[model samples]
Target chain A: MATGAEQAHGAAAPGMPQLDFTTFPNQIFWLVVTLVVIYLVLTRLAIPRIATVLAERRGTVANDLATAEELKLKAQEAEATYEKALADARAEAQKIVAEARAEINRDLDAANARAEAEIAARLAESETRIAAIRDTATENVRAVARETAVEVARAILPAAASDPAALVSAVDRRMEMEGGA
Target chain B: MAVEDGGGLSIKPMDQFIVKPLFRDIEPGSCMPPEIVEGCLKWYEPSNVTLWMGLGIVATLLLLVVGTRGRAIIPSRSQSMAELTYGFVHQMVEDVAGKDALKFFPYIMTLFMFILFANVLGLIPMSFTTTSHIAVTATMAIAVFVTVTAIGFVKNGAGFLKLFWVDAAPLALRPVLAVIELISYFVRPVSHSVRLAGAIMAGHAVMKVFAGFAAIALVAPLALGGMVAIYGLELLVAFIQAYVFTILTCVYLRDALHPSH
Candidate 1:
């Protein structure tokens, strides 16, 4: 078997070194060209796309946070408005209740005043009727007493010597005695 | 046996090793001549695999840019994959270094992908292992160190220098701490580059040695069996090395962005 060193000397063909240069040169050149091309593709194309994607993702996250904040603010505003409305409703309800209570009280007071006036007028009318009745009774009693005195005088005197003055004096004395007894 | 067919002893292929040169045209000391180490800023030879790895880096950048040209709500597949990778790196940066340090994600991700692809490509048959070379790895490490240092200065100006002297030391121990910090800062690139290159080179060397053993001991089934086991282990080591390289880069970037930690 031929050793590598012996084969090197034995295979001293012409243009071998030059051919080595050309062959290796083409291979290395193409390899380098390919590498450069790949690098360019990566840097100019792939890397930028990747960066853009990342930037977009960041933007999305920020936008989402901003939207969340806005929504939270809106919710808070709604809560505040709801609370205000509730308070207004409560205040209005209280005002209505107060007015209703006052109106009822006023109506009750008017009714009470009318009842008192009616009672006072009835009492006055009853007092006036009682006085009239007393006056009539006194008059009837005086008329009856006078009539009885005249009847007694006529019974005691004779027909021929009938004098009105003498008979009245006698009857008055008798009536006085009877009244005293 | 003493009949003379030639003046000198006839040479065979096996005898060449024991004899002087049969071919006089070949220059002495010309075989396997040492190649000159290239300068860092030279226009990289397109034939060199390191240049190809660098091209791969550029390709990754281009793919990202073109994929993300028109952003949509629902992404195309290329766009989605790109986004996923970006998001993954972004999250990692944020998680490792905190949100304040996320600004360095682009640079870190670039470094990670470039190293990753270079490491992976080296695993292919006949492909050049760019990260395996000290010069290439060191260059990358130095670039990272410079960029991070620049970023720190840009962000904090003179205060950035305080990262080495002020933050880690008590007032009484400031001078001693400054010396130690300076040493460590200087050692950063060396450690970073060596770590990557060493792992890759060691792994490749082991794989080659085992493969050679397997070829030479073809008749010995036990040697073949051992080689099989070594090959499997090498595959795992390859992935692990790549991962370690990427993670270390991330850690270094984290340190740069947040020196307080």
Candidate 2:
């Protein structure tokens, strides 16, 4: 085969050296060696390492996704908590306002009741003083009418002046009739 | 061989495909003819194929091993690329070959990384494309063929032969279909290896031809532009061919695992 290849190469034009059969053994030998080296490197080292790296990457991605999901859930839970707190605060503030309003209304009602009672007492005292003054004025007017009548009778007749009792009785009878009218 | 005589341009595009030993003590511009296998290129000789393949292995290790050495859950840029490749091939194996084929993940991953690195690395200027050689690709393909076939037989025994026997066909045409299936089955490795080597070789050869035209002063700019355009295209082809090869491998593995359809 080597001689045949050499004879073929002896030709003027060697054509495609790839067709030269002599190099086949060398190429095949090295090819086998290269393939075996590649196979060993891959099976023993390269493939496993790359496979591990890939599996790790996939796992890392999945883990990241899971972490993101967890964080999202936690954020939703916090938002819900915040909403409940806000609602509670609002309700508490409303209750406090209502209580303060009720207290203010009670104080106002007490103040109003005290003022009304004091006004009623002052009115009753004023009425009693007016009644007493009216009583005194009525007495004074009766007294003046009696005295003026006596004086007029005496001036009209000297003998009549000695009979004051009869004059007094007539005056009393007239005053009584006026009072009734 | 690039030749210029009497202002006439001559470029041998295929000369670049020559598999010569790197340790040539010969004079510059003169290569030891491949016929002198005595000290020229022995079976164990360190040729350009060895160097590039070694580079491919180093690239494989750099991407897969050292890139992920951080083992960080949050990967670095190179580590991310490493992980992306891992997931890409892993999912491909699982999806195309089935979950039962997960045990073969390492093997599939090896092939994918090796070919992918080799293809991409070949794009470097002045670098030898190890995968462009039929001998190299054929070896890998044959290995896959043998391994998959062995696994099929070991797992399914005589039932593995059902792969070539299409039961869905009409009973009258079953034998004819079986013959076709059998031939196609045997041709899998040939097509597989050839497809990869051919794609790489053609792209590289075309680039070389375009580059050769650059020697002419008149169309130099056009040649350079074409080279740039083809370079961009070859970059795409580099990754796509790797993907195609790996996917086809998965398909073949699927057949081996099931061997019914």
Candidate 3:
């Protein structure tokens, strides 16, 4: 292609090299070569590397997300296990409490039974002792009454005085009749 | 090239757009032409366009090739940028043009890198705007047009022509819409190339105008401020234009792959 000045004196247009067809071949030729060079650079070198980086980034992202999801699931499983273990522990604690309460109630019942038996035995012994004392007092009052009756009789009428045995027999006979009635 | 209409104080905006041979006024003892200049392929003569274009390639390769040499799981800054560009273009092609069009993703990326770097590199002082020239951008646009058209024909057979036919419209309007659609379809390359070139050219021209105005001592500050503002706007335009060009290519590829209407 001829230079802008090299073109025949007045053949080329006065303005706009773009409109000047004489040099179009040269410009177009370089444009094509440049385009081809750039195209080759992009397709063969630049774009592929960029694509690889992009794909790697995507792969990294996907791998990270998958790992995160797996970790989340593991965390959830661990949480469930923790909850279940806590529930088991709680249930075991309740069972232990119920068993302890039952044991305490049994021990309390045994202690109460033992104490009641001892009190009942003590009351029976005391009742027996009281009966014995009453018997002794009844005998003493009879004896005293017999002795006084005899003395009074003797004082009142010496001639009409009776024996201690006869007086006691009479009192005993009257007490027996009243008791029967 | 631009001409000073009034005097030397005035600036010529079009001079930056001129193309020249890389070797100029070379004396025998001064310098020798590079191997590429004297290579067997006489067809491949390096010009200013080729020089800037080569720089654009080196820049692209620096970011994509050398920058990503580490390939660190955690990318370096340049590697990250390269990856971002790759993903952005990859996704655009896959999403807009469908999975089948992913095969052509490299081509889309090439166009994007070339245009994007060309525009951005052009912003530097004394750097040429390769994309601003229809010579460069038109070539890319025509290449996309041809590739997609071929894909359409090969994949969809003669049904590829259905892209121009409007079956949804009423029978009377269908033909009219088809005619309009056909004209628009054929002009894709022209508009595609013109849009990028025009945007870049206009921005540079406006900056030059401001730069020229700044030459006047009275309004130097205002002209400098305006140039700064426009330059900032142009920086944004540089990236946006590249994005627009690439995405439009994807859209056109989509139509070719699935030319239903």
- Best-fitting candidate, scored by lDDT: 2
lDDT digits (tens) for residues A27-117 of candidate 3: 7788888888888888889989888988898898899999999999999999999999999999999999999999999999999999999
Candidate order (DockQ): 2, 3, 1
Indicate whether candidate 2 or candidate 3 has the larger TM-score: 2
- The DockQ-based CAPRI class assigned to model 1 is incorrect
Scanning candidate 2 chain A in windows of ten residues, the lowest lDDT window is A4-13
Task: Show model 2 residue runs off by greater than 4 Å.
Answer: A1-13, A63-87, A119-181, B1-4, B25-40
Taking the tens digit of each residue's C-alpha lDDT, what string does model 1 give over A81-129? 9999999999999999999999999999999999999988998888899
Q: Give candidates' CA RMSD values in order.
A: 15.3, 6.0, 6.9
True contacts kept of each: 0.19, 0.70, 0.58
Tens digits of per-residue lDDT for model 2, B83-143: 8998999999999999999999888888888888888898898888888999989988998
Give lDDT for model 1: 0.60
Candidate 1 regions exceeding 4 Å error are: A1-41, A54-181, B1-44, B54-81, B166-172, B217-250
Give model 3's clash tally: 0
lDDT of 3 at A179: 58
**Which tens-of-lDDT digit does each residue in B117-144 have in candidate 3?**
9999999977788898887888788888
The digit string of per-residue lDDT tens for model 2 on A1-181 reads 5454445444534568688776688889888888899999999998888887778778989999999999999999999999999999999999999999999999999999999999999999999999899879877876777677778878888688788778778877887898789
